[model samples]
Target chain A: MAREGNVVNLVENFKTSIVMPTAQSFPAKTVPVMESDAVATSKRPIIRIDGVTKTYRNGTNALEKIDLDINAGEFVSLVGPSGCGKSTLLRLIAGLGTASAGEIDWPTSTYDAKGHPMPDLGFVFQEPTLMPWRTVFDNVYLPLKLGGVKRKDAHDRVTEALEMTGLARFAAAYPRQLSGGMKMRVSIARALVKRPKILLMDEPFAALDEITRTKLNNDLLHLWEQQGWTVVFVTHSIYESVYLSSRIVVMTGRPGRLSDDIEIDAAYPRNEAFRTSSDYGEYCTRVSAALHSASAAGDGEH
Target chain B: MSVIATEPRRLRLLPLHFMRSETAGRWLHAVVPITFVLFLVVVWEIAVRELGVSKVILPAPSVIGEALAQNWPVLLRSLAITFSVMIEAFLLAVLSGIGMSVIFARFRILEMAVFPLAVILQVTPMIAIAPLLLIWVGLDHVDRALLILATVVAFFPILSNTTLGLRSVDHNLRDLFLLNRATSWQRLVELELPSSLPYILGGMKISGGLALIGSVVAEFVAGSGSATGLAWRIVEAANDLDTPRMFAALFLLSGLGVFNFAALTALQHLLLRTWHESAIRTER
Candidate 1:
C-alpha cells in the first residue's frame, strides 16, 4: 500500500518547491509559541493576511487580528471547532465578502486595471453546488463561458478537467443523475477547469462518507502536487487535516483567532501506508490536542 | 477494484428500471383519467335518456353530440376566434410577465413601486374589471379589450413565480458566479433564467388556464355581436332556447380548457423532465 515508487516520483517533483519550515513537529501541548514561517519559505507569498479582522453588522467578530502568509504551492488547512470562523477567513481570501479591518494582499498575484485580483482563483463550497440543469461538461465549462469563451473554444479544457476528475465518461450526465461524491467531483472539475493557481476549499468533502472522503483526499493531494496550486482548505477533521495539508492552522471558537500553526514535515504522495503509519497518527494526535485546547481556551474566556 | 468493476453494471440497470416504471406510470395516468371520463359520459347519456329530461333543460350526451356535429362549421369558426384570442393573450402575457419580472429582479425599487399594483390587479377580480375594460376600450375595439383582459389575468402568475424563482438561486452557486465575475446580463441568461425556468413553466400552466377564462369572461361582458367567440355562441344558443347547442358550445369550451392544460403540462414535462424533481417520475 505504501507504493514506494510514488514517493520517488513525488520527491523528484518536490525539488521545484521551496523548503518549508518544519515547526512544532509533535507533542502539541509541549510546543512553544509559533515562529512566523514567512521568512522560512523564502519564496514570495501568494496571499498575505495582515492583521485582518472581520466583524459582522451584528457585532460578532468572526476573525480577529489574523496574520498569516500562504506561500505558493503549499497545502494549508484551517482546522478548528464549529464557530471558529475558518470559513469566514476562507471567504475573505476568496474576496466573496469584505473584511471589517486590515488587508489581504496577493503580492505575487496579478491585478487588472480595476484593482481587482486577476489571478485564476477557484473556490469549492461545503456542498457540491452544481447547476442541476447542466451536464457535467457544461458545469465545468461555466467559468470559461462566463469569461466569454464559446463552447467550441472551451471544449478541450473542459474535457481535460473532466478527465482529471475521472468524470469524462459522465460528461453528459446531469447533476441529479450523479452520486453525491461524483457530484462533488464535477464541482472540483468545474473549479479546476479554469486552471486556477489558487484553490480555496471550504470543507469540500465533508458531506461525503468516510470512504469517498478518503478517496477524494488522495485525489486532491495528487491534483495539488501535479498542478502546483496553492490550496487553502478549511475542515473540522483533524485526521483529514493531518493527512492532506502541509501546514495546519488551529483556531478557537466564537470570535475566532489563530491559536497554533503546526507544519507537517511528512514526504509527498502520502498513501494508505502513510495513513496507517505511526507518523500519521502522531500528527493527527497533535492536531486533535491543539484543537481541544483551542476550543477549551475559547470556552474559558466565556 | 471489484467495487469499481461492478458499479457500472448497477448504474446501467437503474435507469432501465426507472424507465420501465415511468412508462407504466404514464400509461396508467392516461388510461385512468380517460376511462373515468368515458364512464361518466355513458352514465350521463343513460340517465338523461331514461328519465326523459327535457332537451331545453338537460340535453342528453347523444343529442349534444348531434348538435355538435350539425353546427361544426359555425362551432369551428367560433373556436378559431376564441383560440386565437387565447393564444395571443397567452403569448403577450408570457413575454410581458417574464420581461417585467427580470426588470423587477434587476431593480428592486421598481419592484417595490410596481409589484403591489400588480397584486391589486390580480386580487380585484378580473370579472369586475372586464365590463369597465370593455367600456374604456370601446365597442369598436372589443377584440383589443378581450386581449387586454385576458393578458391581465394571465400576467401576474408568471411575473410573481418568475420573481420567486429568480430569487431562489442557490446562494453558493451565486457566489460561484460572482467569483467567476459573471456580468449581470450573463448571470441572467446562464444562471438566473435557467434556474428559474421550472417556476416560469409552473406559472405558465396557471396563466394558460386564466387566459382562456379571461377571453370567455371578456366575450360575455362585451356582449358585442361582432365577436364570434364560443362564449358568444353559448349566449346566442341560450337566447334561442337551443339547450343542445349551448351544451355543445360549453363542451367545446371545456375541451379547449383541457387541451390548454394538457399542452402546457406537456411543454413543462418536455422542458424539465431531465432535471426538475416535480417533472421526473420516480419508482415506488
Candidate 2:
C-alpha cells in the first residue's frame, strides 16, 4: 500500500510539475525554421557561432570559418563524413575547448548569483561514459551534485530523469552490470537530470545495434516533444540526421566547414509510419546527396 | 501466464542452488589443502624416523613439537617481539608511502626530483644496510634499527603502485570531471583515490610478506641478545646446536608469513568486493 501510495504521489507531482506545463507550452505546429530564414526573423538566437575557426597546436585545421545560428527548441543535426570535425564543433559550443579565431556568444547568459556560469548545457558523449564505480542513480546525480544541489532536493529530478529514460528499475545497478544499451540510457538520464536548456549529443546512439538505436531515437524524439530543449546532435549517419533533425547541417571533411543546411519540413511525432513512408526516404536521399557532394568537394581541395 | 508462474519459482530456487554450491565449494577449498598438508607432515615424520636421521643434523617434527611445547613462554615472547616490529614498520610504510604518493601526484617537479632516489632505495639490499642502521642508531636502540630496515623494505611497492594507480585514471573520466569544473581536491578524492584502490591493495599484499622478511633479516643482522625476535632465537639455537629449537622457530616464522599474507588478502577482498573486477569471483 505504501509503495502504491508513493507511486501515485510521484505521478501526481510529476504531472503537475513536468508533464502538464511541457504539454501546454509545446503545441503540434511549432517546427523550427532553417538558419538562413531564422536569422531574418526576430526569434532570439540561443547560440551564435560567428566565423568560428579552430586550428590545433599540432597544425591540424579541425574546423574553419563555421558560422551558424541556433534558435530555441530546435533539433539540429551536424551530419558529415569521418574527420569532418563535427565533434570538434560540438565540443567548442559546449565550451569544452576554445575556438582559435572567432567567438561563440550566448546572447542570454545563464549565470548563478555568484557570477559562476550555472551549467545550462548537457553533453552526451559518444560513449556512455557513465562512472563505472557509481550506481545509475549516483551517476545521474553527478551534475547536480557538482552544481551544489543537495541530495534531498536532487532526488525528485533524478528520479524523473530515470523514469523518462526508462531506467527507473535500475537505479541501483552499477554501469558494469548493465547492458550496453542500458548504460547509454543511464548516460542520457545523467545528461537530462540537469534539465539543461540545450543538449549537445555527440553521436550518442552510434555504438548501439540498429534496433536499440531506433528505439532510443524514438524515445529521444518523445522526450524532445515533451521537453522542448534545443538539441545539437552530431552523427555520421545520413538516415539518423534525416530522421531526427528539423534542420540538418552537412559539414565537409578535413579543415571542416559547413557545406549545406537542409531543412526537413516533416511534422512532429515522426514515427515508424514516417520511417516506412516515402517522405522519410526522400529526405534521406536529399541529405545523402548533399553529403556525397560535400565529401567530393573535400577531396578536390586535397 | 504459466511461464510467468514458473519463472518466480525458478528464480527462488536459483539462489538456493547457488548457496549450496558456494558452501560446498568453501568447505572443499579449506579442507583439501589442510588435509594434503597433514598428509605431507605425516610422511615427513615417518621418513625422518625410519631413516634414523641424526637429530643434530635434522630433527623430526615430533622433536620440534616437543621443543615448541617446552619453550612456549620464551618462544611466544620472541614471536610477539617480531610481530610488533613487523606491524609497526608495515603501518608506517603504508602511511608514508600513500602520503608521499599523493604529494608526488600533486607536484610533478617533486616527483621528478625524488622518484629516482626512491627506486634506488627499493633496489638496494636491506640486509646490507641493516648493520649500518644498527650502528647509526647505536646498538642501544636495536628495535628502532630493525623498524627502519623493515619500513625501507616495505615502502617502495606501495609508493610505486599508488603512483601508477593515480596516473592511470581514465582520460575520458578526467575530461568529464574537468567539464564539470570539479576542484583538484574533489577530483583526487572522488576519482583518483577510488581508481587506485585495487593497485594499493595489490601492493599491500606484497609489502605485508616483505615486512615480515625484513624484520627477521634485520634481527639476524642485529645478532644481539637484546634483539629477541624469532630470528634471533634461531641464531641462538644454531650456536648451541639445538636443532629442534631452530626448526620450531623456523616453523613459527613461516606461519607468521602465512598469517600476514592471509590477513592482508582478506582486507583486500573486504575493501574491493563490491565493485572491483579483481575481487569479484567469476565462474568461468
Candidate 3:
C-alpha cells in the first residue's frame, strides 16, 4: 500500500533512456543495403569487448587480452583460482577500473574520448556495500534517485526490487541491523532496482557462510531466470561456478588469460536435488581439471 | 506521561537507540532509597533535638529550611550570576572547540601545531594563571574570560569524540557513498554528522559538569566583589563562619551542577530522541 498515485510511476520518468534520432543502419539484413549504401552503424554491443587487457604494472598481469563477448541477456561467470583474472574481468565490465592495453566494447557502454555515449553500468561489490546510514528501501531507491526519478514515484520501484530479493519485509531496516545474508540481499535489491541491462557481480557471496551462500546461489539463479539481464559474475570457487553458471569462463593466474570456456549443461531452475546430484559432481570435477590446466600452463612443455 | 517503560525483556524489541528503559523507571526504582533518605532525615531531626546538638556545626534540616527562606534572594542572585557565566562559557567553548576540531581533523599539520597548545591550556591550572589573567583582563572580564578557559578545557572531549565519530564511518558504507560520487558536503551531511551525534552528546555530558567547576574556580581564584557569583558567596559565608549559609551555597552549587547535567541529558534525549542508542534504550 502506498500513498496517492501509482507507485510504479517512476518507470515513466525513465522513458528518456534511449539514444537520439539516427538513420536506420543495419549491417546487411538482406545484403542489398550494405552493398549499395554505407550507413554508419550503431557499433553498440548490447555489450562490446575489444582487445581488453589488464596489467597491474607488477609485471604481474591480472588479465591479458580479456576480449570476451557478452550479448544482451547472457549469464556469464568468470570462474578461476584466487589470483586469476575473474574478478578483474568483472571490474572492467563494471567500469570500476580500466584495462591497460585493450578496450571493452559493451556496444552499450563504449564511449569515445568526448564521452558522447557509453552504456550505464550497475556494480554489485563482493560485499553488500549497503550504506549503513540508509534503510534497505532507501538503498534500493538510490539508482532511481540518481536517475532523477521523483521521490514519490521511486518508492514503488524500490519496493518491487526489495520484494524481488525477498527483502521487502526488512525494507526499513538498516544494513547493520541485518544478518549477513540479508545485507547481501539488500545489495542485490539495490542493483536490480535500477534495471541495468548489464549486472556485474564480483564474488558477491564469496565471504558468506555455506548454507546462506547456497540459498543465495539458488535465489540468484531464479532472479536471473526471471530478469533475463546479462550477468557477469566473478568467483574463485569452482564449485560455485558449476552450481550456478550457464557458461563459465575459466582463466589462468599471474599473466591472467582465458584458460577455458566450459558450458554448464545442468537444466534450468536448479534446486537442492541438483546441488546434491552426481552430475553436479562430475561437472565440478571437469571444471577443476580446466582450472588445473590453466594454473599449470607451462609445466608440461619440457 | 506514562511514557516510561518499567519493563526489561521488551528492551530488545525497540530499535537499538530506544533501549534504555531502566532510566524511565527511575522514580519507581528509587522509591525505597528515597524513603530511606526521608527516614534518616526524620530520625536525625528527632535525635538532634533530643541530644541538643548545637546549630553551630550541624543545623537541623528544619532550621536550614528557615535559613533557605531568609537568604533566598541573595542565593538566587548569586545563582543567576554563576549560571549565566556557566552558559556563556559553555557556549563559547563548544563553538571554538568544534570549529578548531574541524580544522584540526582536516589538516594534520594544524592538529600537530594546535593540539599541543590545547593540552597546554588544559593542563595549566586556572588559579596559577588567574592573577596574571586578572591583571591582563580586568578582574571582572578576566574572571568571566577565565570561565571561558574552563569552558575550553571542558570543550575538548566533545570535539575529540565528535572528530572520531566523523572518522569512524564503516568502509563498506564509505564505498557506497563514494560509488554514488557524492560531493564532500553531501558525504559529511549524510554520513558524518548522524554517526557522530552519540559521541558528541556523550562528550557534552562530561563538559557540563566541567563548565560548572570552571566557573566556580574562576570565582575562587579571582574572588567575588560587591556583586559576583555563588563562589564569591561561598567565600563570604565560609569566612564569616556562617556554616549553614556556606552549606546552603554549596548545596546551591551542587544543585546547579545537577541542573546543568539534567538539562544536557534532557536536550540529548530530545534531539537524539529516535536516533541514539542511549536514548533508544531510555525510550524503550
Identify the leading candidate in terms of TM-score. 1
- Report the C-alpha lDDT of model 2 over A203-278, residue by residue, as the tens digit: 9999999999999999999999889888999999988888888988888888888887777889999999889886
- A43-150: candidate 1 lDDT, tens digit per residue: 446787777899999988889888787878889999988988999999999999999987787665678899987766899999999999898899999999999999
* Positional deviation of residue B75's Cα in model 3 after best superposition, in angstroms: 1.9
Report residue B241 deviation for candidate 3 (angstroms). Answer: 1.7
Name the runs in model 2 displaced over 4 angstroms. Answer: A1-42, A111-119, B1-20
For each candidate, give the TM-score of chain B.
0.90, 0.91, 0.83
Top of the candidates by DockQ: 1
Q: With candidate 2 superimposed using the best TM-score fit, by how many Å does residue A273's alpha carbon deviate from the native?
A: 1.1
Compared with the true structure, what per-residue lDDT tens digits does model 2 show for residues B1-284? 12333434444523444445767678768988999999988998999999999999988889999999998999999999999999999999999999999999999999999999999999989899887888899999999999999999999989999999999988767777877778888788878988898888888888898899999999999988479999999999999999999999999999999999889989988887767888778776
TM-score of the second chain, cand. 2: 0.91
Q: What is the C-alpha lDDT of each candidate?
A: 0.88, 0.85, 0.72
Q: Give the TM-score of candidate 3.
A: 0.74
